[model samples]
Target chain A: MKRLGYLLGKDMRLLKRTPTIVILLALYPALVAVLVGLAVGRPPTKPRVAIVNQVPENKRDIRIGGKKFDLDKLTKALYENVDGYNVKDPAAALEEVKSGDAVAAVIIPEDIVEQLESSSSQGTIEAIFDSTDPTRKAYVENTIKGLLVDTNNELTNRFTDVSLDYINIIVNGGEITFGGETRNIEGLANGADLIKDVLPYVPAQQRKDLQEFAALSEGAKQGANFAKSLLRRVGQPIKLQNKPVGTNSSLSSLAVAVAVAVSAMFVALLLGAGMLAYEQEDQMLTRLLRGLAPRSTIVIEKTLLAGICALIVGTVMVLAFGAFVDIRWERAFLWWPAIIVASISFGAAGVMVGAASGDVRAASLASFMIGLPLTAAALVPKGAVSDGLYSVLQVINSIFPFKPSLDFLRAGLSPGFDALWPGIHLAILILAYCLIASFAIKRRVA
Target chain B: MPVLEGRDLVKRYDERAALDHVSFVVEAGESVAIAGPNGAGKTTLLSMLAGVTTPDSGSVELPGGKLGWVPQKAAVYQKLTVRENLELFARLEKVDDVFGSATRMMDRIELAHRASDRAEDLSGGMRQRLSIGMGLIADPAVLLLDEPSAALDPLQRERLWELLGSLADSGIGIVFSTHSAGEVEGHADRVIILDGGKLLYDGAPADIGPGAHFELAFINFLRARRAHVNVGGDAE
Candidate 1:
């Protein structure tokens, strides 16, 4: 124990002398935290899309229920609804998309107004999107699709409203103007009543014909009433209400903090391995072994020193992330235990690697090769991988420190934190790694 | 009584024997030099005596059970000051008064003036002295060094030999390996020469070959051993 203290003191003095290493130890995690915080805290940038309007300017208006609706209004809505720019033709818009200046292009046909005016035809809007990058393509596609749906809904509602107005005028006996002539729709319905009243005085064949005409007129009015109700339903069939579950807005920041803390663990591992391997490569291990100190003392000292350095880095990273993002600083009591245990666990594993490798360069390389894959596996979501692969990852997470440490940190950030299981997991890992390190050191010195 | 003894130490690597049934003893206040050609098992012998390597079929006996080892290279921490390095080693050796012993060691190694300087900033000779001082911090009954002066200049080598002479005079046993025949004859009170894992000579330098120069005598001894092997005679 006394020798361990001495070894630790020597390491501290050496660390003080190497300013570059000390600075890097603190700076690396802090930088990672700040960058990740900014990335998650800020809103995403909108993707640019090109709009091609091919409709003729002279015939851009269509009359609906005596109200002039301009086709240019649709184009203006598209521009206001999306981050879009105007292009002259479909080819030019496509070229913009292909050149990476825009993510997608929307083309409105030249005869769109004519199609809207005709009851038998519908307007078609063509959309072209870049598909080289799948994620960007999905985003652009969703944005354009949403705009098209909104436009379709607006057109449907206007058509429904106008149709309902004409139906009311015809069904309830009113006058309407059409093609420079005013006609009383009530007079046409009153003719059926006149026919019915005169049916008894006419000849037998003529009276039968009059009775059929009067029934047909009454059926038309009832049909008009049914169509008006159907049109109202067609305008809006389903309504959606959005309600999010959690009130915590700092979830992204918490995730960034966890990621930065995990990175700090890796830094601790590399530092511990490199420092121990350097002792051997520099021939200091031989001299150290010649002293009365036990081999376990050296391993423990290295593990503790590495852990302390990494803890400092992790603390700095958490604080830096908090500056950029809202973090639950009150949960630091819970976070400290997790960070301390995880740092020491990884540090002990690093010392084991160093002892087995017995060379500084080899130890550092091995640390990265082993740590990166394990950390990646641990961090991968269960839904992202197949069942078999996720099962294997679960086993790795149970044995390694990365997953448990991440979980501990996430729990600390959460509203309700339970420290029992994660604490036990980290304790087991630390013990196992320290034992392995001790064995390796003894074998190396033997 | 002998301060250290090795009884027929034999160490092998796969098909080659690094140390073949080697045996020796060091008395207190004695300075012994192990002289040999390349791959002659000098380091293997010193390593076994220092307890750094275990012989496959032999035992090393040090009644006091305290040994100090200085490896081929200067093994002191380069980032630490000379005084810091000495004090650290003293503490690691579990000395009661770490600072006092470290100060004494600095003066003994003649590095007290540069005690505050980092080992990396020191001259090669100063670093070597610091290495030796680390070895002496424990005040062991026997000290073993492997090629301690291999990289030193002539003047540095002379000063190292002077330090070793004084240590021996202070009643500590020292065993060091070297390739220089002059070091074997001039500095060592006794010499042990090995070749091809076999001991060629073990006696006073003057007694190896009467009236022959020590270096020539050493060469002729090796030639005679090869000739005996060529004639299919026993080499033991």
Candidate 2:
């Protein structure tokens, strides 16, 4: 229809004439990305750990194949091996772990060499661990555990395959030594990593053994016990400003996405409200209604204008995301349609306000109503949100094309969302919005 | 046959009637002027005839002719230059290269030098003339002008009269509404008078009777009627 072309042409012309609008559209993505960067964002890093070497001063010299090593040497090796982490000492080290400074702790056995030569199971080599920080603790435990095992295997050949016997020694009436020589206190040590001395890496607190007092059934709750202990140590309401979800390399991206979705929908609502409101204010609507030019022309033109603006904005956002956030654009082909649908759908809603309000100023009330709630999607993650609120948001988002487009963009960015579904989302958004906009047009005429 | 015919047309706003059983017809190629004071419904009638508003009760019958309408305000895009406004209208009306026509129309109105200025920046009289130029852009069989002579200087007014005379000579049926008796006396072929939503006179220019002082006269009549309603007294 001539009306349709008229509207489309006018919108196209406006876009061509206005350079400011072009700039506004372009900055949308970057602005949102930067905003999200401010909230819950930080750089990538490894865990810091502290080691306490309890070996005697002489026995600290533990030997391996052609490698004479001491606790200090292994500590140095661990430091050199790991990246982005520092090995700190007892006095200054783990103030972070104790004051929640270090992620984990490592302690080496004193008679480590003696246990390796004894060939038997008289005494055990050991290490005490702080289970408070799993990230740091896991790394310390694995490295020490693997190294001791290798040392134990090498020690078996040193005795020429003799029937495995052991050594015992006494000190202060305590059976400090067992099975063999009154030997070097060093001979009773284990160069090996395992230690029944492998006390279950427990926190320094909660020393009450379950075997002594607590219900056997209570200790039976394996994972629950760990959780209860950890909760007590950490207290409630844990918070970290830059906790990065495994899926995102940075938390800032999420914030940026939320802002973009919120703003785009807002602009859409405003555009729609202006359609009829402007005419009514200027008495143009009355002139329009009486003219032979027909009412459909006005609606079509407004819708087209909104669509064009949406395209420009969406394209700019897509480009910015690619440049700064490392977004994959090849898969972004579907974003175009989604943006268009959202633009027109929101624009139509705006027009509805204009038509209903009778003037531009009156349309502001409707803009506020539609925009505020729709912005919630930008504020909270879908999964973290309560089920009831999420459902309500989903329904509200369905009311406009912008909602679906934003959803698709986010879904596309996140892992596990297939490209096909986002494309489908975009299609539905465009078709549904255009239909809704057409209905809005019809209402304006009526 | 009449170029435009309406029978007992009625338009109601909420509970009150704006045009109550109004009837009129204009012959082809005739320049008719609608005369009325404020609230006399002169605008309401012109708007209806322009096809911008529809009658609730009566129907209008037009026999195979085009209509061009001009509103009272400038109604031109302020951001656009004069030449731009014309081309926009021309394109909107689907006329071919309406550019040439717009150029000629501008020269006729003596606005050729000011053609490059935005419609908003123009003087009030220039803006009015530009609005007229827009109405005549399509050069339809029927030209509808609402308050055409409003806010025009003497020279501009004379120029507008000459333009209307030329349009009438071209056999374009021109219908204009005005509160000015000078327009009706000097130019119009006939005059139709409306008073308080009623047709008080519908005939030749000579048939206006003695009511050239219409706005003052109508206000007095309304005042007297108001007094009669308040205090039981004879009125009229």
Candidate 3:
């Protein structure tokens, strides 16, 4: 044990004496932290939308329910909430969208106030989108839809002929009114239940009008509820709530995790494969083997040195990520096992490559050939690769150690995360890598 | 007592034998030189003696202590300082005092002044001396060197011989291979000549017949061995 410790210390000393390797070990993780900070640090910029309001400047009022609502104020308010530029010419607005200066254009018809004032129909607003980028277009369209919907709802609530407090009563499961009679319907939970409670109290003459209005109102309420649900689904397909248990947000957590994994892999490969090959090149390996130290000692000491380097790189990456960006350290302790396992597994892989090649140049090429895909497997975001390719990568990744390490990291960062199963699985994978590496070292190099 | 012994060693590569039925012994304080042509299997013999590789069919006996091997290439860590390199080997050898061993080697090689210099920065002769110093750190019972002076200048080779003589005098068996018979003429206590992986002669350096240089003697030896092999084949 003491001999191994001294040998490991010597390896570390040799590494420290190597300037290029030392610089790479320190710089790679620092660069990763900065890159991650740059990539996902700030909130995404708002998309530009061109708004062409055709309502006359002189006539800015829409009369409804014996009250006049300011049309100009509503339009100004909507534009303020978005990166909306006002353009007079509709052609110019469309041209801006075509030129990529704006993602979409909102064209309000010239008689918007007249239409809003008309109790017969709702106003129509047309939105034209640039189809160059479908994802950007979808985001822009949803934003515009939301803004317009809110405007329409505000107008409906303010100046409608009927203030649907009565209709809202049924929707909200509060009270119902019909035939100048009101009844509390708090106990009822559904539309049908409310209708059943109210239908019996209506007089014969008012029955026909009340029944028709009730049925129409109930249907409108149901349609509105369905639309609200649909709008939510359209706005965001998945709602992942990053519970603030440790870091301020999930982006920071993901960035840190990826940085650690990437840096750990490189450090491992550099120390494991690079060092092994270096020993061979120096012809010092045979001399070392000719001594009292066993071949297993050499393998173990090299691996331990690489593992130490990996731990240093991993810790630095995580710390730098946390320092440069907002990350939760409350559960930072939970992530250590994953970080340590990642270092060891990746280091063992490097040892395997080095031992197998038995040449530094060959080991270097092999390390890169192996490290690149494995690092990608752990750190590449899902959508970054094509759907088909990503699925294949996922399958390939699952068969390796990095994926389990990443899984363990992700589970640690997640909210309400109380499971230790992934961590145990990762530990097992790391153990397997170590065992295989030891066996290979003993058989091939020993 | 014999510090090292190998008997009837036969190492074959495919159908060709690298070393065939070669037998030799080294006593506690003997300086043995293996003299041969380039492909005469001196290195193969040295490898077996050093226990670096196993012979196909031979028993090599060594009463265990540090058995040092200095390969033809000066294989020290180029990045590490001379002192650090020695310390590393000392640690590997499980030497109780790594610093003491390193210091002793540095002083003995007359490289104590450049102890802090990286091995890569050292000159060829100094690097070779460092390699030898690393071998001596463990105080080996027998040191096997494969063409140790092959890369050295005449002055460096002379200095290396003087060092090897001192090591042998201090009771460490020194077995080294050389291409030049002149290198072993006066320095070596015993000479073993090999031709075609077979031992042609083993005796004191002065007993190789009269008025003949080592190269000519080696040619004559190969001719006699080949004629003997042909005669045996015809008889068979």
Q: Each prediction's DockQ?
A: 0.47, 0.25, 0.39
lDDT of each residue in B1-236, candidate 1, tens digit only: 58899899898878787777889889988999998788888887886777666789989988755778898999889999999999888877888898999999999999999989999999888899999999889898888889999999999999999999999998789999998888988989899988778777788887777336888887777677777763222223
lDDT: worst 10-residue window of model 2 chain A = A163-172
Question: CA shift at A307, candidate 2, in angstroms?
Answer: 1.3
Query: What TM-score goes with each of the models?
Result: 0.80, 0.62, 0.70
Candidate 2 residue lDDT tens string, B1-236: 47777678787777656676778887767888887667667787887777766777887767636677777765665556788777767767677777798898798666899988877789877877777777777767777788887868888788878888887887877789987767877778877766556665677776444454644444454455446543222222
Query: lDDT tens digits, residues A328-375, model 1?
Result: 788778777777877887888788888888998999999999888898
Worst 10 residues of 3 chain B by lDDT: B227-236
The CA root-mean-square deviation of candidate 1, after full C-alpha superposition on the true structure, stands at 5.6
lDDT per residue (tens digit) for residues A1-446 in model 3? 87788778777778777788799888888888788877777776767889898877878787664457788777765676678889997998989888989888899888988887676987888888876787886887788877776576556456432344433454666655554586776421365556667888978788787777767766776875665455445534577986655434366776677777777877886678878777767767667655456666767677777888898888777777666676667766777767877777777778767877777889989888887877677667789989998988887787566767666676555554543766676566556655665565444422
Off by over 4 Å in 2: A1-3, A14-30, A33-259, A275-292, A357-369, A377-402, A415-446, B37-40, B149-162, B179-187, B195-198, B211-236
DockQ class, candidate 1 = acceptable
Q: After superposition, how far is residue A424 of candidate 3 from its true place, in Å?
A: 4.8
Positional deviation of B160 in candidate 2, in angstroms? 3.9
TM-score of 1: 0.80
User: What are the Cα lDDT values of the candidates?
Assistant: 0.81, 0.60, 0.75
Scored by DockQ, the top model is: 1
